[model samples]
Each structure stands twice: as C-alpha cells, then as structure tokens.
Target: MIHHHPDSNMMLEYASGSLNWAHSLVVSAHIQLCPKCAAQMKLLNGIGGTLLAASEPVTAAPTPADSFERLMARIEEDTDASPAAQQVGERQTTAARTRSRKAKRDPIFASVPPVVEKLLSTNPVLPWRRLSKGLKEARLTTGQNRHEVAFHRIAPGSKVAEHDHRGKEITMVLYGSFSDAEGVYSTGDFLVREPGEVHRPTATQNQECLCLSVVEAPVALTGFWGKLINPFLSIRPS
Candidate 1:
C-alpha cells in the first residue's frame, strides 16, 4: 500500500494541468498506482468540466471557412507524405503502447504506469551507470529546463550519500522499499524533498529498490566523500 502521496497543492496543480511536463508525468504514474489519488483526480476532472460548461462563450471566434481551409492545407501536406513511412511510425507507436499496457498488468512492474512504461520503452536497453558501489542511475531526457528525471537502483541494504537539495526533489518508489531519517517508504510512495532538506536514503535488507526521481537542481552533499564526488554525481538530462 502507498503510505506517502503528493501534497494536496501538487495534486491540485496536476488536476488543473498547471504542473510542468516532468512533474505531471511523475504524478500521472503515481496516480495509476494509487487509488486514492486516482479518485481525487477524477473528482477534480469532473469539477473542471463543470466549470468549463458554466463559463461564458467567447464573443468572437475564428470562422469555420478559415478552419476548413487550414484543415485542407494540412491534408494536402499529409497527402504528399509517404504512406509507408506513416504506417511504420503508426505501427511502432501502437506496439509500444500495447507493450506498455501489458507491462503495467504484470506483477513485477505493477506500480509502473503506461505513460512511464511508454517513455522507458523509447530506450529499451537503458545503460545504467554506477553512481557508487551499490547505486546506479539512468537519466531520461525530459526536454525541460532546471529539472531532470531519472531512474535509480539501490542494492539491498545500501545507503545513498547524505545530501541536501539545492532546489526541489521528488521521488516515487517503484519497487521494493527504502528508508530515510524521516521514515521508511515502500512501493508506490511519493516523497518530496525541498531545498535545505537533508537525508540519507538506505534500501531495505530484503530486496533491491528502484525509484523514479525528479530534481529541479543539483544536490549538495553533506560528507567529505560525498563532497568529493558531488560534482560527478549531479543528475543531468540525457
């Protein structure tokens, strides 16, 4: 069961489509694993729809003829495109989505949502690089500034270097469990750490832990060794 979740404000932002793309993606994945958040999102969506329906109509809008002309021009451009190439692209996208859906149903990755799976599918063989003896990470390209998303794997009973965030950091446990100074976090837990918050995360003894993490800025290590490697350990976009 999920013991942690995104704060109410974050959830509200996600529901209202106010979150950044990277943050939204992580929240979306968490919603799939969390029934409570999913229900909350549903309620928010309903509220949004109601508000939209009650809103006043625009005084003026683009003419239908202009829209039709633009549509026709787009169709003409598409007609000039290669059908075979389009078919191949469509097939690849469909296959990836199907595979992602199937993966979500599997027990091994039950916490992984379709969106996360689909994004990871783009790079089937992720080259996980070692951050430390027992810690490894694989960065994901999110095309966003001042933030990054990545997957991190920690060996059982291993502890990450103690550090304090320079900005904001969010971590979602995807597999196994880990613990920090605050508390122990299990699968599906959404943890948020802000600038000036410091903690050392250690994986549980029973199994390895995998987490999807997003950080807005590089972290500042607290120890001598951590400080020595902090520059190299900084998370970067792929």
Candidate 2:
C-alpha cells in the first residue's frame, strides 16, 4: 500500500505543468505504481483547471518581435551545427550499440524490461559507497539542474539514523519494504513526505530493498555523523 502520497508542493507543480520532462518521467513511472498519488494528481489537475477557468480573462498587447524570425534563426543555427552534432551523435550511437550488445551478452541483465532498459542505457553507474550500516547510496544529476535524484539499496534488517527532512522527499519502493512511524511500504509503494517530517526508516527481514528517491533540497541530520553527513547527503528543499 502506498501510505504517503506525493507532498502537496510536487502535486501542485505537476498540476501547473511545471515539472521538467526527465523528472516528470520519474513521477509518471511512480504514478504507475501508486494509485494514491495518481488520484491526487488528477484532483489537482481538475482543481487547477477550474481555478483558471473561473478567473477573468485579461488581454495584453502582443510583443513586437516576430516569432517566425526567431524560429528561422534557430533552425539556421541548428543546420550550421548539424555536422558537428552529427559526429558527436554518431559516436554516442556507436557506444550505445556496443553497450546494448554487451547487455544482451549478459545473462543477469537479459530479462530487464525494455522501458527500464532504455532508461538505464545511457545512465552511468554512480559512485556507490557505503553510507551507513547496511546501506549504500549514489546521487544522479539529471542534466544541470539543482534538483537531484538518488538510488538507494538497503540491506534487510538494517536501520538508518533518525533524521528530519529539510525539503520535500518522494520515495518509491522498487523491491522489498521499509518501515517508519506511519507504516510499512513494500514493492511498488510510493511515499511523499512533506518538509520537517522526521522518521527513522528501517527495512524488514529477509531481503534487501531498492528505492528511487527525489529530494528538492537536503535533509538535516542530527548526530555527530549528521553534521558530516549533512554536507554530503542531499535532501529535498523545504
């Protein structure tokens, strides 16, 4: 069961169509696994549309610049750069093809879903080092944005430090379960926590867990390690 839906802020952004394509893709993927967030997103969409329609329309003077000219200039620039772009593009293409062949040769990765496979095709492995007891994590920077997402692997029977969040946090369980004060989350469960919420999350016995998490800012850790971890560990923004 998805105990905590995405926090109000993310849903609000989604309703207003403010999410970037890459992050939106992750949210959409989570929505597929979470009915609660799906429902909330739908509601936010309706509410936002209604609010917009309810407001009075205001007319403004059009800008003097010609949009067509701007588009034509951009197209011309792209055309001029196409050769160099193609060279880089070709190199990346060859690399991807080589990787695909390698993946096909690997038996363990053969059964991965095409969507996940396609997504991971270009993703390089992060510097996965141990964070705490039985836990390892790595951060991913989706392009040049301040927002960063992370992938976490928690060994079963392991517990993390009790900590408070600094911003919004969204978590989707891909495998196994993690428990906190609210409830336990199993595979496909989604949890969206608001800022200032505190919890010590621990995995259940028997198996390790895989989770995808996104944070806007960073979480505030409270111990001696927390001071050190705070500098390195990123969390969602408040």
Candidate 3:
C-alpha cells in the first residue's frame, strides 16, 4: 500500500499538463501502481473536462476535413520522399522497443508502467554503477531536461549513504520497500525530499527495492565520505 503521494498542487500540475516530461513520466508510473491516486486522477480529469466544456470553444480553427487532408498530404509527401528511410526507421524502433530483457518474464520488472517501459526499451538493465555496497544506479533519459532521472536498486537490508538534496527529489517505489527517516515507502509510494533535508534509506530485508528517482539537482552527502566526493557530483541544467 502507498503511504506517501505527491501534494495536491503537483497532482494539479500533472492533471493540467504543466509538469515537465521527465517528472511526469515518474508520476505517471506511480499513478499506475497506486489505485488511490489513479482514482483521484480520474476525478481531476473529469473536473478539467467540465471546466473546458464551460469555456468558449475555438471557432476560428480549421475544419476536421481540412486538417485531415493537410495531415494526409504531409504524411504522403514524407513517405514518398524517403520510403526506404522510413522503413529502416520503423525497423530500428521496433528493435529498440523489443530489446527489454526482463520486462516480459521477470516478475519484479514485468509490472513496469508503459511510461517507464518506454525508457527501459532503450536504456537496458546492465552496466549499473555500483555506487556503494549493495547499491547500484542506472540513469534513464527522458530527453535533455533539467531533471536527472534514474533507477536505484538496493539489496535487502542494505543502507544507502546519508545525503541531502540540493533541489527537490521525487522518488516512486516501483518494487519492494525502503525505509528512511520519514517512514517506510512500499511499492507505489511517491515521496518528495526537499532541499537540505537529510535521510538515509535502507531496503527491507524481505526483498530488494527498486525505485524510480527524479532529481532537479545533484544530492550532497552528509557523511564524511559523501563530503569528499560531493564536489564531483554536479548537474548542468539545460
């Protein structure tokens, strides 16, 4: 069960389409695993629809037939200009999407939502950087954005390095559970850590924990060793 969730304001942004793509991707994944949030999202969507219906409609836009013709003409022009190129592009896309290793058979990862599955289609699961004992990280890309997104996997009963965020960091528990100063975040829990807040997360002993994390800036370590290497961690915001 999820014990934590994004605040009302963030959810409002997500429902209204104001959140950035990177954070939106993680939030969407959390909403998939969390029925409570999913229900709330449905309500929010309905409210948005109601508001839109009450507003004045755009009467100056092109007609459906005109838009359809223009869209079809553009597609035909592109296809005619590079049929072979389009075919090759489609093939490459198919291969990339099918490249997921454990997403199909592995129970731990099989439940990944489509938003995250798309990223894994190209990122792969290997080559994880063993940042610390029993902890590994694999960065995922959601275009060139201000936020840095990644998957953090922690072995059972292992504790992560104590650290504080330089900017807001949102984490969604994808599998298993992890506990920090605030509380234990089980599967589907979405929690936010603000700048200067300190916490050390430790995975539950039953199973390993996998979390999707989105950080606006690099984290600063609170421990001695963390202090030494903190200088090397930096985010070049785009």
TM-scores, in order shown? 0.78, 0.62, 0.78
Using TM-score as the yardstick, the better of models 1 and 3 is 3
Candidate 3, after superposition: displacement of residue 92 in Å?
19
Give the winner by lDDT: 1 or 2.
1
Q: Cα lDDT for residue 193, model 1?
A: 95
Report the poorest 10 consecutive residues by lDDT, candidate 2. 63-72
In order, candidate lDDTs are 0.77, 0.64, 0.77
Model 3: which ten-residue window has the lowest total lDDT? 63-72
1 or 2, which is superior by TM-score? 1
Using TM-score as the measure, what is the rank order of every candidate, best first?
A: 3, 1, 2
Q: What would the per-residue lDDT of candidate 3 be over residues 142-200, giving only the tens digit for each residue?
A: 44457788889999999998999999998998899999878889988888899989999
**Prediction-by-prediction clash tally:** 0, 10, 0
Candidate 2 structure, TM-score to reference: 0.62
For 1-238, candidate 1 gives per-residue lDDT tens digits of 8989999999988876667666776787899899999999999999988997999976655543344335334444433344555687776776676566557553445547655665555545666899888899888764445568888999999999888898898999999999998999988899999899999999999798989988988888897876686777565653
- Model 1: CA > 4 A from native: 57-111, 231-233
Q: Return the clash pairs for model 1, or none.
A: none
